[model samples]
Every structure is written in C-alpha cells, then in structure tokens.
Target: MIRRMTDTALSEENASLKARLAETEAALEEAVEAQRRLESIVGELQREKFAARSEKLDPEQFNLPLEDVELAQGVLEAAQERARRALKGDGATGPRAPARNRGHLPKHLPRIERVIAPESTLCPCGCGEMTRIGEDTSERLDIVPAQFRVLVTRRPRYACRRCSGAVVQAYAPEHVVPGGLPTEALIAQVIVSKFGDHLPFYRQAEIYARQGLALDRATLGSWVGRACFHLRPIVAQMRENLKAADRVFMDETRAPVLSPGRKRTKTGYFWSVVADDRGHGGTGPPVVMVHYAPGRGAAHALRFLEGYRGRFVQCDGYSAYDKLTAVERPEGAWQLVHCWTHVRRRFVKRLETDGSPIAEQILHRIADLYAVEKAVRGQPPATRLAARREHAAPIIAALRPWLEAQLSRIPRSSKLAEDIRYTLGLWPGLIRFLEDGQLELDTNPVENQIRRIALTRKNALFAGHEVGAENWAMLASLIATCKMSDVNPVDYIAQTLRSLLDGHPKSRIEALMPWQFRDPSSLAA
Candidate 1:
C-alpha cells in the first residue's frame, strides 16, 4: 500500500511539472514575438532617421506604403490562423488579425486565355464525347519582355521627266537632335529609363547591346542632354507653379558630383520643392521641382526661396530652415512649418536602442494623431480642422504634461531626455498642424520625391559633373510629375519633344505641362 501511494504521488508531481513547463514555453514564445516586432519597428525608424539622404528606401532598396500594409496583413493572417487552430486545442495562441479588405485584379488588364483539355473527352462507358460543361478560370499577372524595335523612315523622291524640273522630296521631320540616329520616341525611352526607372545610360547601352544594338553610352547621353536643354523651360515653369501655392513642401538630399580633374567626387545637394494639396481636397496637380545646388547651406536655401510667393513652407528641423522663419517675405511673415514625422523619429530611435517604455508610450500617442488624420484626409480644411479639434487636440493637451513629467524624471543628459527636449523645443511647429487643416502632419510628400533622386543617385554612383547633375534634376522632375499625374513618362517626354521641336509657342508653354499633355495627329513647325 505504501509503494502504491508513492507511485501516485510521483505521477501527480510529474503532471504538475509538465503543466508548468508548457506555461513557461508559451511565455517565452510571446516574449520573443514581441521583441521581433519591436526590432522591426526600430529598424524602419532608424533607416528613416539616420539615412538622411535619398530620405528613405526605394524599391532598389526599400519603402512603399504597400510594404507596411502587406506586412501588417501577413502578421494578422498568421495570428488568425493560429487562433483558429488554438480554439481546437492547438499549441499556438495569439491575437487574430483584423478583417481584410482585398481587391480583385484590374478589369482593364488584357486577358490571355488558355484552355486545357483532358487526354480523352469521351465517356468511358459510351465511348462518345461528353456534353460541354462550365469552366473554372483564374488569372495571374504576366509581362512581355521589352525588346528593341526599329523604324525605317524613307522619303521617296519624285520628278517629272518631261519638264526636267528639280527633283522634289518631302522635308525630313525636325528631331530633338537634328539628323541624329535616334527618333523622338527612342530619345524619350532613354530619358525615361535613365530618370524615371533609375537606369543609367551605360546600363541602358549594355541592355541595348544584349539585343544586338551597339549604341554607345555617350551617344545616348548626348540625346538626354539635348532633351533636357529644351525641357529646361518647362521645369522652370513648374517651379513657379509650385511657388504659387499658398503652402509648399521642401526637402534636400546629398548629391555626389565628380570633380573634373581631382579624380574624386564633391558633395552637392538636390533640393526638392513640392506642391501637393490633394490631401485637403485642393484642386491642384502635384508638382516636384528638384533643384541642384552646390551646397546645402543658408545661402542656398535663401537663394532658392527668393522668388517663392508662399509664406508657409513645410520641412524638417534643419537650422537653415529655421533661418527662413526670420527672413523678410513680401507675402507676409515666412513660416517654418515643421514635420511631426521627424519628431517621432527621434523617439523611435531611442526606443530601439534603449527599449525605453517612455518612447513606446510616445509612439502610441503619435499613432493616435495619425489615426485621426487618416479619417479626415481629402476632406475640406475646415472639416479636417474640426476633426482635429475634436480628436487630436485632447491627445496633444494630455501628451505635453506627460512629456514634461517624463523629462523631469529621466537624467537631463540622457538621450531620451535630449529627445524630449527636442520635442519641447519644436513644440510650436509640431503642434501647428492642429491649428491648420490645410497643412500635413509630416513632410513625407517631399521626402517621397527625394526618394527617386536617392535611388538614381545610388545606381549612377555620382554625376560626372555638376552640369550632369543639373540635367538629372531637370529630367527627374518632369518624369516624376508625369507619374504623379498618371501620365506615361515615355509618352509625355516624346510628345513634349515633338511639340517643342515643332515650335510649340512660348506663350503656350503652360500647355506643355505633363498634366496638360495630349497627343495630336500632326506636329510640324
């Protein structure tokens, strides 16, 4: 009887140990998942905060809104699957993802059909063909590889033998590059490839060579320079149009330029001045004017903003921008509207490195502001302002005291303290979004424009000269604007070149804007 009781006690002890082990393992898994998520958030914020130039990732590197959405979607789906399994006594357990809203493939896309048939359609018993039935179909996206094509232009000459008159032939068309081997369309492709797709000229030449065309890089680049030279007026006009807006966004990225004889590169800056009002339901086309400056200093910013008509300019916390607020303005007082995204970035960095609870709380509060912005986006300024007053103002009112309290608790010399101080320092500008609904909560729009410049800069490594950099800026601006307007860069560039060569009137240059672009049956001077 004592041996039987001892065995029972040992069996019960073993069960208790197993139960505790399972609980411990689950807790470990939850901790690991939380850390993983924290690391991902920190990494993204760090990349944005530290990778100052080219602002954020491009596809060649990273950053698209789709990326964040897809990530969240994937995590949510996995959690839901786990929850479903766990309800039936599975090991995994976690939060389920929110309901998904998905879209079908575009109906406008051309459908290619392929019908598969069984080896024998005959019925086994009757040895006769079966009656037709319904079909099941699915679609998968596909692409046709790009290939080079040629256009052989011939102008036939005619003469009247009886009169011995001078032979008559149709005059060859005016080309962007007179008597050049490339057609306007081909030149457009080269410009689009280099500027829009971020493919360099030499890379383009190599691509062409693979297709049995031996075009040299210099030849292709020559076409680009000529096209940009003529397109200069359009880019200049775009800048004026952008400045005409009551508010604009501006950002700058580093540009490495080759020092002609030094055999090294000198650092230059590409300033992106943007005008986009769609977020507040303003009926204006978005424009990006990338200006190349020899340096990123107060002098450059001052000179660039010289003719800007607007008083409000949204940007980061660069000291040069601070000086703008003090500058004399004909339109009234110059205002430096700061970006909340920049403020949040500092705390995100602290969170990742220190795992500070303070940073986490700040991020959550900032997220609340963004959620309110999302609801009022595209609404009228008054509507947005009303919503902000209702939803975001209270959050800000509560956050300020909390920030100061936290600041008082942390060491004054600590990095978190420094970040909190930065927030407090820019308190006015950061909260300015709450005052005006027309303004954005961040300078993401301009940074997004800088992203294109950053990507091409990465691929080309550095511009061969400052002039080359200027040319890059001009073409990139036009192409990016075309994209914003949902116009094909290739078509837009080609049409513009044709019209310009055909002497499209200088007074009508405004009609040549990408958003105003259209194809006509005939183009001749």
Candidate 2:
C-alpha cells in the first residue's frame, strides 16, 4: 500500500511539472510576438522619417509645371509662326506650307553680285576692290503670348404671316450655355493655368487683372470647381479602372486644409494610386488617380481599393498595407511587394553617416543594377525582370555575406549600423523583387509622381480647405496623368470640358481618359 501511494505522488508531480513547462512556453511566445510588433513599428517609423532623405534628386530631374519662361524655343517658334500667319490674313491652312523647294535656295538668300564703283570704293587693305567678309548680322527668335479672338453668332428673326405669334429664332446647339461669357478656349485656358501651371485661382485672377481683364478670384474658383465636378464621373471611373488592374503602385504626401474649428488647418493627406492598365491587356485606359482624405491611414487605402481584386500592390514598407495581407475574395489576390530603394536608402544614409567602405561598395553594386535598368528602358516588365535576374541577381546574392560582415563589425549605436540592421531586416522582401520581374526594384516611379505635388506644396504651403484640397487632387490627377500620357494638358482639358458641357453622357466617361484619346502620332510631335 505504501509503494502504491508513492507511485501516485510521483505521477502527480510529473503532471504538475508538465503543466508548468507548457505555461512557460506560452508566455515566452507571447513575449516574442510583442517584441516583433514593437520592432516592426519602429522600423516603419525609421523608414518614413529617415530613409528617403539620403538620396536627394536634382529638381530638374522631374519636369515640374512649366513656368512661362521655360517653354521650349522650338515650341515657341512654332507658336510664333502660327501667330504671324494669322496676322498676315492666313487662315489655319498655315500660309500654304511655303511650297517645298526642289533643292534650291529661296529668293531671299540668293547670291547677289556686288555693285562696284571703280573710283569711289577701295579695299581697306589697299586692294583694287573691297569684298564682304561675313557682315555682323543676327537672327533673333521672338514669341508673343496668345491673343484672344471673338466669334459672334447671329440668329435672324421671322414673323409668321397672318398670325399674331412671331418666330424669333431657331434652337441653339444644346451644350453651350446661352449668354455665357466664357468660351471653350477660355475655359481650357483656366484649366491648364490652374493645373498644369500650378497657379492658384487668386494668382490667376491677379494675372488677368494685369492684362486688363477684371475676373474675380471667386468666379475663377467657381469655374474650376464646376469643371472638376463635371469630370468627377471620369475621375471615379479612373479610380475604379486603376483598382481593377492586377498591379498597382501607391504613395501619399501631405495636403493641408483649412477648418474653422481647428487651430491649424494645414494638416491633411492626399493619397495617389497608379496602375498600368496595359499590364493585364486592359486596352481601355491606363489609369492614375489621387484621392484626398482627412488623414493617412489604411482605411484610405481600403476605400480606394475597395472593389479592386488585384493580384498585387507594390508600395514602400508602410504599415497601412500590412492590413491587407489576406482577404476572402480574389483568393491569392493581394501580395505585398516592398521597395528595394527604400531598403537601400536606409543603408545609404547609414553609409554616409558612418563613412563605411563596405556600404559604399554595396551602393556601387546598386548603381550597377540601376545602370542595367537604364539600358533596358522601353522593355516590358517581364523582359526587364529576366534581364535583371541574369545580371543583377548574382550581385545581390554576393551582397549577403558582405552585409552580414558589416553588421558584425559596426557598433549598434552608430546610425550606419542601424541602417544596415534595418536593411537586413527587410532582406526577404527586398530580395523578393529579383524573383518577380513584374515588381519594380523601387517605388521611385510613384514617388517621382509625388515630387510634383511636394514642390507645389512647398510653394503654396497648404490648400484653403478640405473641399479645395480635394479639388486640387482631382485636377492634379487628370493633369498629371495627361502629362504622363503625352497628351497636351490645354487641349485635353478644353476638349473634356467642352464635351461635358455639350451634354456628353457621364456613363461612357472612360473614353475621355487622356491615355485612351492619345493618338500615337500626336505623341511624336
């Protein structure tokens, strides 16, 4: 009986020990998970605050909105030639094309025999006759700002015979507003001036005042506001089309707003979404859009991508994207591809701070990768990916040991050391780009687009209110995408505004997209 009781006690002790071991393991796992979340948050903050400042690009690298002074000489020359033709009573046929010459000089430059007076003239060198040795004459290119012309439409009145009622006129074309002062051309000017030129409405008003046109800022704002409202359906279609794309690239920058209750109204965000509609054989339109939100959060993304069941989204390592790691519909739908440039940027900053030779070498290798990218400029994503894998993958693989070695030697407190550590942390995501050709090495394309807004932001500081900022976003979306697709901003804005005013139905708004309407031949000019 004593022996049996001893065995029971031993079994009970073993069970207690087993339960304690399980509890300890669970606690350890929880601690590890918490540490990971904290580290992730810290890394995200580092990426947002510190990463991009390392590689500063020249402002000229981006084509910021053209100031009047920056128009190309040839373009201005063309415009001037047209104006001269118009002033000379030549219509749009353009002075009859100056008839092509059969390999002969024009009469203007024909060689002329010199008139000589034997007794009156002598060469300065005391020769028998003087000769012209390149006269000091100059040819100057000149331009004039576009001058406005008015067209008046007259309708005749007729009286009905043997009737008291009189017929005054025929019905007017449906789209044009009766007695409206603004013409399609004038409306186009306003659109391009505000969006392409980034001149605020008030500034544009001041400009018009200089020209003796007393247009109110409020009226100009009303025109812009109405123009954007007219195009909102198209803009909405663009958003939907962008999300429908299998791949999208996104980024955001600050947009300020003015709220009456708030002490500072200049804190808001504008989100940009860019997608290559051509990627999935989407011949409809290549879409790019900007959405203004009160704050920057995953909800903004979720709203933009609400109906999109795309395969992947490529963005920098922003925590907002972490929320979409899995979803029910579009099974295998959302894969997050991080940006290598972001990772490299962290190390680049560190290298600059620490003056590390190894970091420099790694950067040189990255430069080589960029060189390859430059060489394959017009190649499709798949071909580019293949080329990158063949040339860049080996270098990236070779980098692992170098990175590990540097991390070991560097002190943790050093900024360069933290950069290296952060970079290594993102190794799996960064290197994943090498494996998929569709993915970009960096989010620079989207970031490149954002730089324009950043500059306008720098100049203007912030928008007036949330609605005003939203208008800025809508207009920027259309104007920027038009610029990207090689459509003339002036022509497109004018045409779109005219169409919408002329009773063009909003149901087929996608047809108005710049990419859709872009004639390839027009792009060459």
Q: Give me the candidate number with maximum lDDT.
A: 1
Per-residue lDDT of candidate 1, residues 1-525 (tens digit): 999999999999999999999999999999999997788777767776675443223575545647888899999998987787978667554574543422367565567889987789889999688987886455667898887677789999999888986799998888888876888889999998988888998999999898889999999999888888888888888877887888889899999999989999999999988889989999888898888999999888888777888868899988888888777777886787888889888887778677899999999999999999999999999999999999999999999999999999989998889999988888888888888889999999988888888889989999999999888888888988887777788888887888888888999889988778654422111
lDDT for each candidate structure:
0.85, 0.72
Instruction: For candidate 1, give the lDDT of residue 183.
Output: 83
Question: Once superposed on the true structure, which residue ranges of model 2 sit more than 4 Å away at CA?
Answer: 1-140, 149-151, 162-168, 173-180, 277-284, 331-333, 518-525
Residue 458 miss distance in model 1 (angstroms): 1.3
Best-fitting candidate, scored by TM-score? 1
Kindly give the stretch of ten consecutive residues in candidate 2 with the minimal lDDT sum: 134-143
C-alpha TM-score for every candidate: 0.76, 0.70
Q: How well is each residue in 1-525 modelled by candidate 2, as lDDT tens digits? A: 999999999999999999999999999999999987687668657876665453757786455656544768668889998788778765344334443443354333434344433365576677776665643222323456666667677778888898968777876653333466666667767867766676767788888887788889787776677677777877777777676676778888888777767767657888888875343233445566878899888888777777876777788877888776755565464777778788767656556544568778878888887777676655676777788889988888888888788778877786666777767766766776676666666777678668777767766677878888888888888877877777877777767777777777767787887877654333311
